[model samples]
Target: MYHDYTEPTWSAQQLLLIALLLVPAVGALLVALLPATRSRLVAVSFAAVTFVLSVLPALIRPADFGWFAYTPLDSAPVPPWIDLDLPWVPALGLEFHLGVDGVSYPLIVLTGLLTLLCCAYTPAKGLAALLLVLEVGVLGTFLALDLILFFLFFEVVLLPMYAVIAGWGGPNRRAAARKFVLYTLAGSVLLLLGVLLVVTKAGTGDLVLLAASPPLDRTTQYTAFALLAVAFAVKAPLWPLHTWLPDAHTEAPTVGSVILAGVLLKMGTYGLIRVGLSVAPDGAAWASPVLGVLAVVAIIAGALICLRQTELKRLIAYSSVGHMGFVLLGIATLSVAGIQAALLGNVAHGLITGLLFFLAGTIKDRAGTGSLNQLSGLRETAPRLAALLGFAAIASLGLPGLAGFWGEAFAVIAAVDRGGPFWTTLAAVAAVGGALTAAYFLRLLRRVTHGPATPEVRSVRPAITATEWLAWSPLILLTLAVGIAPALVLSDTALPLATLLGIQP
Candidate 1:
């Protein structure tokens, strides 16, 4: 028997998800209203709440649903589980859309954890509000379902990060901050143009819609991809375009560097997958070989740069370039395995590199300098610190049974399995770069942690602080956990990626 039925106006679960997404922004506002002395506590509480909320969706196993609907040229109703799709500036065809899927949920959790950790670890007064604000942007970027909404969230990250660098960083902070803004803003312009072209051409800004039915023809897809690639590349800070990173890492405060390495850079790689490949598949295929070559070069070049780097933070920054290269290489292969590797690499790099920067900052703060040559014999004077540094160093160098290994190994494996002359060559070069990565990190270990105590090291006092330990333990434990069971990240990513790639899960 058939019966008339109506869907509830909105499910409680959907409303809860929307509440989770907005929690940080509301918290940021509340934080701003609080007394300066209480800001940290308020920010932490709200961040913790947001983190809890972010985790809820995973537990409940929500299905896809729509928030609000709109008329389109194609006249198809939007998909479900969109959560919020209210029309905004209907004349421009923009909507305030936000939602999540397997691809984005892990990143949302990463963003929440990193931001909370940064807030807990940072000693700078009057900054918790900004960090909370930044957290909102990072989470929103991952969850945003509309192109315009995504861009807004993406741009929201730029300003707070700039403030963090300029206000809390070291001697060269202002210059580093300016360079960061200029490079990113230039990229943002291109990103906006690309988004506009796609939305205008497709007559919709809905990412799900665009993915289901590419809005543009092949030639237009190619053009859109080119513009979008340039934008994301600058943010990924790919080789030749990567000049802004080392200085930013070196000059920014420890928390800033941690966030930069841990989550912000992921935005670029995520964009490449979410927007570039999905929206412009033909263009991505055409560009894959060239991108693979560039990824290989970035791998080698970043390692080479690390070999010459003397500053601890700069070395870690350069290391990020190489690690992210593995991610880009995996993406370039355009296979299920390659993309999965890229996803794994993305999370692993965030965890390992974040830990590395934190340790580097701790060492520098205690020793009063970051110069590897001048800072020696940490093993003798600061055994605990040296031991932690050694642990982080090995993990970052892709030691077996560490978080870094699975991603780097799988990226190379995927390239080999891709079975083309270009991919084969790229795989070989990347493997060699992996060796170079180990060498440079070993060199860093020898120069900074293994020698006789330097005068600075001998005079240093204070072990790792409670806040530092609290902030670090998660990354350290997660590194080992993921190392031992890469399936934690891989399993969640596999089906979503297969969907993205039009392959069977």
Candidate 2:
């Protein structure tokens, strides 16, 4: 069910949604055309406005007759707080349909905030412009309710990100960018096929309608889910499909990595919940066991890989695999608790990992190396940077009373809640993986911040920049805020998850 805003045709909410997409988009073009010196100001201003707009949807209370009001148990599964539907391609049976709800609103806000930070932090006009363009793609992906529109927005992110990596990255960036594009393009092909399959079979491309009452048969659902799952898994970069990630992270620039880890990867998990399970319940159930097994494998494998990594960025990159594994595990459970954990985990990972990448980039820039062994006793030289790194690492390790704890700890709990021999065992192994996460992070802290200061550390500047503080402070604060009160992300999610899982709210 959608909110039937009783306001006039061009309502405030409608314009707000339009501005959310349009502002950054126009900003990108303006930033590109403007003088190099003014680009940062223009980009940040657009991103700031976009971020502010992103939050308003959550505050707009539904009317008495809206979806949020008391309704029967058979309410629409994919209800949006605000939705806009307009004709696009009649020949393709596609409409320009977009909506937002608890499931996507958090991610939208996250994308906006991170992009704003990245734009502010980057000095290059081209990079800042690309970040804004990337923001538009990500926000559009979260907001799109039409299958074709979703796919279009999904593809829009690819080239700009490719340019970011290849244009401003470490050595061997070309190979990494090529791999990233080729790998994700393969997934995109699969995604297009899946979307077309669903549309052809169901004769419509509207996700809200399909999710509310799936028109596909069991076999169709199975095929659709399989295609969609692999496609999203590649983006999620689940386990073996994740080969592209560490390379991308290691080679990409600071802002690129932040966006890539922060909210870009989220498109996968969000798609899994929104498209995979919703469109094919039976297929998801059929595939749950396999998904569960792979998720646990990713958890253990990613953690174990992180322990052996020598480069700081590479280590942090691999850790995302492990963290995302927990998210996939939660989704595999297909319970209300499991999905909610996934959502919370998604937001948590974005905040904590984005900060980690930012800190890592700063440290590497100051010390002139990201090698864990070569860099030691950072606290002796750059206490502020080291302290921030320590905080981010601790948070990434899932320390309680921080943002990272809820998603990971509860993924295990949700698995236990799932309660079968296989699930129980998977839960146990995932718990072990969590232990490994802590071990590696402790090792990282010990290696980088605890020992005697090296020559590189000695030469490093101790002061933290105002720009760095402006970029990182929100992530640090939000990590604690969401950790202390999980409700910040989970508040609007319950009804949506319950509805998606076919459980009573």
- Which candidate achieves the best TM-score against the true structure? 2
- lDDT (CA) for every model shown? 0.83, 0.90
Q: What lDDT tens digits, residue by residue, belong to model 1 across residues 279-376?
A: 88888988989889889999999999999999999999999999989999999998888887888888998898999998999888888999987789
After superposing candidate 1 on the true structure, give the runs of residues whose Cα lies further than 4 Å from its correct spot: 1-10, 63-83
Best by lDDT: 2
Error of 2 at 45 (Å): 0.7
RMSD of 1: 4.5
Q: Look at candidate 2 and give me any clashing residue pairs.
A: none
Query: Could you tell me every candidate's TM-score relative to the true structure?
Result: 0.93, 0.97
Runs in model 2 deviating more than 4 A are 1-10, 63-78
Per-residue CA lDDT of model 2 for 1-505, tens digit only, reads 5534464433677777888889999999999999998999999999999999999887774643242333533454546777788888877667998888888989999999999999999989999999999999999999998889999999999999999999999998999999999999999999999999999998988888877778889999999999999999999889889999999999999999999999999999999998898788888999999999999999999999999999999999999999999999999999888998999999999999999999999889888999998889998888888889999999999999999999999989999988878889999999999999999999999999988999988889998889999999999999999999998888667777766666776
